[model samples]
Target: MNDDEKTRDYNKAVAAFAKRYLPYKQPLLKTIENFSPELADVVIRHGLYEIWEEMTPLLSYRDKEIATLAALITDNTVMKEITAHTENCLIQGMSKKEVLEILTVLTLYIGVPKIINVMDAVKQAFENYDQHIKNKG
Candidate 1:
């Protein structure tokens, strides 16, 4: 495909993926798109659509989410991503109990300081998810 065609295809793919997996993050996505449309396309197509979409028998979506959450804590990423992934974890059938267990284990490896940040994000994610369900009903 030509440059324009490739950009269009990537944009389309990003939109479809976001609609399915990132419906609640429109404002953040739009901000990135506004700052640098090309960067937004790269992020959506590569990060969310490609790597996140892979779910093999060896690494199911739930496992991937758990891993992602733990890695995010270790890397000290933005709170919004942590919150978003926490929501995705619940959507993928990860119980709150399991999330707690994972976080507890991660504290040893990622340290208490990082877990502090992660816990706040986790709390926000739960609150947001609860509110979202309430609004839907």
Candidate 2:
């Protein structure tokens, strides 16, 4: 495809993926809309569609989710973002026990202090998952 065609395809795929996977909250979307159109475009087009889509083939969704969780735990990332990703991990087929184990292992590498917040996030995710299951049933 030509450059224009490729860009169009990427845009479409990105929008669809964001709607499904990385949907921004309305306030966040509005902020992006006003201040950083290019960043918003890259997140949708490149981060979700291009990067994540390309990586999905190489790693199982669960595996990628676990890896992402591990990295975020180690790096002491934004708690809310980490919690959201943990929820995504569960939604993508990771078990709560599995997530806990991954976080436990991360403690060895990143130290215990860094893992405290991750543990709390994982606990919240598990509670939410359980609530979701109960609601479904």
Candidate 3:
């Protein structure tokens, strides 16, 4: 395919993928775009097009959310992302028990103190999910 066609196809694929799997992020992306348009483009193109699109087909969506949540839990930075992915874990069909279990597993590797921080982030996610999404339906 020509360069223009390739770009078009890539964008189309990103749109479809983001719509289904990444809708939780649209508000965050829009907020970032409002302050930094170029960074927003890079986040969208790199994350959706390059990262998620490539990785998602290799795992079920639920598995992908688990993996992402685990990574965010371990990194111990990016509190907001940790919260977002924790919520996404539920949106992807994980029960609250399953989500909490991730913390139990991570405690073995990350130690109790760090896991404490992760626990609070997860608590916020759970509260948000319960209040906003879980009982609505």
The residue-by-residue lDDT of candidate 3 on 22-63, one tens digit each, is 355556655866888667556665565656666558787678
- Candidate 3: which pairs clash? none
- Candidate 1 structure quality by residue, lDDT tens digits, 110-129: 78888887788899888877
Better of 1 and 2 by TM-score: 1
Instruction: State which candidate, 2 or 3, has the greater TM-score.
Output: 3
lDDT scores in order: 0.74, 0.69, 0.74
What are the runs in model 1 whose C-alpha is more than 4 Å off?
Answer: 1-16, 19-22, 54-58
Q: List, residue by residue over 1-137, the lDDT tens digit for candidate 2.
A: 57686578556755544443434332554475468877776765566666677656787666777787777777897777687678778778777787778777888898989988677777777776677667868
TM-score of each: 0.78, 0.76, 0.78
For model 2, state the Cα shift of residue 32 in Å. Answer: 3.6
Which residue pairs show backbone clashes in model 2? none
Candidate 3 structure lDDT: 0.74
Output the TM-score of candidate 2.
0.76
